[model samples]
Target chain A: MTNPTAAMLVIGDEILSGRTRDANMHHLAGELTKQGVDLKEVRVVSDEADAIVAAVKALSDAYDHVFTSGGIGPTHDDITADCIARAFGVGIDVRDDARALLERHYESTGLELNPARLRMARIPDGARLIDNPVSTAPGFTLGNVHVMAGVPLVFQAMVASVVPTLTGGAPLLSQTLRVNRGEGDIAAVLSQLAADFADLSIGCYPFQVNGAFGANVVVRGTDGGRIDAAVTRLAGELGL
Target chain B: MTNPTAAMLVIGDEILSGRTRDANMHHLAGELTKQGVDLKEVRVVSDEADAIVAAVKALSDAYDHVFTSGGIGPTHDDITADCIARAFGVGIDVRDDARALLERHYESTGLELNPARLRMARIPDGARLIDNPVSTAPGFTLGNVHVMAGVPLVFQAMVASVVPTLTGGAPLLSQTLRVNRGEGDIAAVLSQLAADFADLSIGCYPFQVNGAFGANVVVRGTDGGRIDAAVTRLAGELGL
Candidate 1:
């Protein structure tokens, strides 16, 4: 069977505005790849209610699982939790368990669990909390969509907490051969290899390093043997 | 006047497979921000025709300008040109101008102008070529979408060629105030500052530096004076 498909919605103006270069998407992409989940699409949208809700619905409907990052902080701009609730037509409010967790963490840290901190306790109806070991503020998984924090450390912790629980297929495997030639010189052979190994995804990423043209030919599929064969054949053909 | 809105479509399997991290998105976002072109959304999809076509249509229809990177190379998987033609229901073929550019560049570089290299000459009908200073292969603009190479250097070059041509509003200005407090402590006052300066987008990005909670409050708007005023008000209100 094919791997479980997934999509990610990155909700934050910082990313879109060039104020921040997002590390979360790259981190999640790597994590999901290891988990054997196929992340088909990733959309970065500014933190707007309508955009978040629309993207959540579209991604949730299209993929087997949806993952979101950002817009969960205790600030005025953090509206991802509310937007997820609206997307699924679920009622959301401060949940006691979440509040207690935040309350306990804040009390121990000598921080007040004020209204702003309390916003972190809002949970959508019928949602399970995704544990965040980095910070006490928890992320929640609502139906097929897993909502997580934007901070790299917190997002990684939440992904670790949630990914193992999802059903996964065979681990996605890949092999690469770096060719010391332009993509133009390597394209034809790569194309033939791609056609021969139809099940595998053969991609050529060309690069210019030190003013010399080269490319990395990556062959990916669930079957490690097929990937090995493709890489071997490519290396032999390229005489590399 | 509101800045012209833009969206970016990143097409590749390497990115989805976690083999490569995209740099073009961040580069374009910064470029557009400086140009006063509001980058509203960014979507990363694999090298699939249907997904690429659907996203092309959706983004093209939604935004004033759509910038696409990747899938424009000479590899067999580089189907972006064909997909763009199909998305707009237009015919595409190698144009004389593009072919000549590639022919001259390849000849000068002593690389054979093979069929794979010739593939770069294909341009959708009614499209205008965007100059690529880094590489000879030209990116093209069709309708509202500007399709550029996935390579960071080439993509940035194409962006430079295209962005200056678009009608831009006032430059997006911003100033940040660093608060040595947790987001929870700063949230209430930040909310009031946001409301008071609704025209300026006041964004609070929190951080944990050496185990101390802190945040950077960024105020952005077309008017530099307004951004400064919002930051000043926020700093005063926070007693900083």
Candidate 2:
């Protein structure tokens, strides 16, 4: 049986403005794929409460898991925690557990946990904190919606901490074969072969080689033997 | 005056699965930014029709313009055109204008425009074609939704054709100062300065430098004078 699917909601105005090139989507995609949890969708929204609430509710219902990144920072724009709380129809406040974590960090760092900073401690009720080794601000998992940080280092660390604890399906396996041919040149034959291998997903990624275009044929599947066989057949047919 | 805000809807399963790293979002963001339009959100949904319809409707109503990439292809999975039509409560069929373009291309290339290929010609009623110079398949603009090809080359060409036709506002001006400072060391000052520049957006992008984290600070604003002032103040504050 195929593993359960997941989605990602990247919330930030900075991302859309091209002020921030997102690293969270790429990280989550690679991580989820490794865990056999197929990332089925990804949405990047602004810091608006309505947008965040709408996307969170919609995606959480569609996929088995929904991991959100950004807008959970200490700044005034950080409204993801509150928006998520509302989406889940739950009340949120500064939790003792989260506040303690922030308090300890500020004490050690000798930095005051100001009102803006304290905003990070307001997690939705019933949500469990995901450990953040990079920073004291804790990420929380509310049902299937995993709320995380926007900063790449902190987000990656939090993801690493949370992913290991969840149940994973069969790991996804992939192999890439570089074909010094264009997609149009190999489409017909490759399409037929792709149809034959029903279980495996074959994707042709085109890249420029010299002045011409070439394709890197990638075969992905849970079954190692099937993937190997498909690669072999592909290489043989392409005369590589 | 600010250019109206826009959002991108990337309709593809390939992106979510990490089979394809999305080029559309980057391309659209840069293009819109240059045209003085602020891209506010981006959503990457699967090929599922329902998901596509929901995303299209929601995004169209929210933004001044909605740009959709992917799903307009000559394959079974290419369902973007139909979905957009459905979302608009419109009917989709093979339009004469689209068929003419495809017919011309087929005649020139001496390739049969098969039924599968003709699927590319099917477009929503009352839609204007967004020409594809690189490929024969034409994208179309209906209402506020500009449905474009998923292929990067085709998508870029379509965007080039569409951007010049749209009205725009004041373009965002930005300047970057590459620094060899760690974010942690500069956090307090940077945070304070960022708070001061309400109209300007300051983003700290960290990179690994000699096994240490170093960041390049970027300041963005619609007013060139404000951006320069912010940068000057930031430099003075950071003692750079």
Candidate 3:
């Protein structure tokens, strides 16, 4: 069976403004690959409603799963929950289950659930809440879209909670052969190898270290035997 | 005048497949911010032709400038040039200028300019070449889309070459105040400060250190005086 396809929507002005470097995309990409889901595309947009709404809707429609990080905090810039609601045409309000989660956490911490903190309980209609072990604010899953936090720890916890529930295909297998040669030197043979291994994905990643050029040829596919075979053929052809 | 808007397209499956962490995006983001250009959106797509073409066309039409990284090598997966040509409906060929640059570099390095290496000279019709100081192969600009290499060193050098030619607006200025307070505690006052200083972008980033919650409030705008005033008011309101 074909692997489930996914897309990521990273919403934050700080990331776009270059005030912060995003760690969530790389984390999610690695996790999704391990879960046997094909992450097709990733879009990072600023904290604007129109851009967020359009991106959410487009990605949600195009892929099997849509994972979003950022803009879910209690600050005024936190507009992701509202955008998701608008995109799905659902009315959002402070749901009892989510409110209780926040209430218990705050009560234990000797903190009051102020109006701003209460914003974390706002969930769209008919959505399942994703657990956040790192923080109290709960992310919700409405349809195929998963709304998670921007914080790396919280986002990763939320992803760990969500991926197990998803049906995954065969795990992608890959083998890499790092050759001490320039891409131009290996291009001809690599292209022939790629054509021969039509079902596999043959990728050439070139690198330069200490003024010497080299390339790492990676062979990836679902079948372990095919990847192994491709790597062997590649090594023999390159005389490595 | 408002800042020129830009979008970045990061190509290559290594990034999407979680095999490599992308450093080029962060470098570009910081550089663009310094150049007084607003990087509004970023899309990470694989080396697929249709996906690359679609992203190039969409970003080029929506923003003032589009910067693309990856898939410009001689390998079969390096299809960015072909995709860019298709996106603009232009023919591509080994232009004389680019080929001559490669020939001279190869001659000096004592490397054969084989057919595979010669593929790097392909340039779309009417496109101007962006010099790559790190490598002999040059990046090119077709309309507003700049096709750069996947290698971080080469990509950065190409950006440095291209950015100086474009007109820049006022440099974005920002100030930050780190407070030992949770987001919930500052959300109310921060919201008011944001409203009062509508011209500035007031951002609150929360962090948890050693089980204690704290936040860094950043005030950003083109006007220095306005940002300072907003920061002063915010600090006073927060009692910090």
Q: Residue B89 lDDT in model 1?
A: 100
lDDT of 2 by residue, B1-240 (tens): 667989899986667776667877877888888898989889888777998998899889988999998878665456789998899899999999899999998789776777767878999999988888987689999999999977788788999999877798888778998767655456566678778998877766555655555666778888999889888887887788
- Best-to-worst ranking by lDDT: 3, 1, 2
Interface RMSD of each: 0.8, 3.8, 0.7
Q: How many backbone clashes does candidate 3 have?
A: 0
Error of 1 at A106 (Å): 0.8
Worst 10 residues of 2 chain A by lDDT: A204-213
Off by over 4 Å in 1: none
* Candidate 3 C-alpha lDDT tens digits along B1-240: 799999999997998889998888888888888999999999999889999999999999999999999999988889999999999999999999999999999999999999999999999999999999998799999999988998999999999999878887888899999999889999999999989888889999988899889999999999999998998988898887
lDDT of 3 at A139: 96
- Per-residue lDDT of candidate 1, residues A1-240 (tens digit): 889999999988888989888888778788888888999999999988999999999999999999999999899999999999999999999999999999899999998999999999999999999898888999999999999998888888998898888888887898888889999998999999989999999889999998898998888899988898999999999897
Which runs in model 2 stand beyond 4 Å of their true positions? A106-116, A175-219, A226-240, B89-119, B174-240
For all predicted structures, in order, the TM-scores are 0.99, 0.82, 0.99
Write candidate 1's Cα lDDT for B46-137 as tens digits: 99999999999999999999999998888899999999999999999999999999989998999999999999999999999999999899
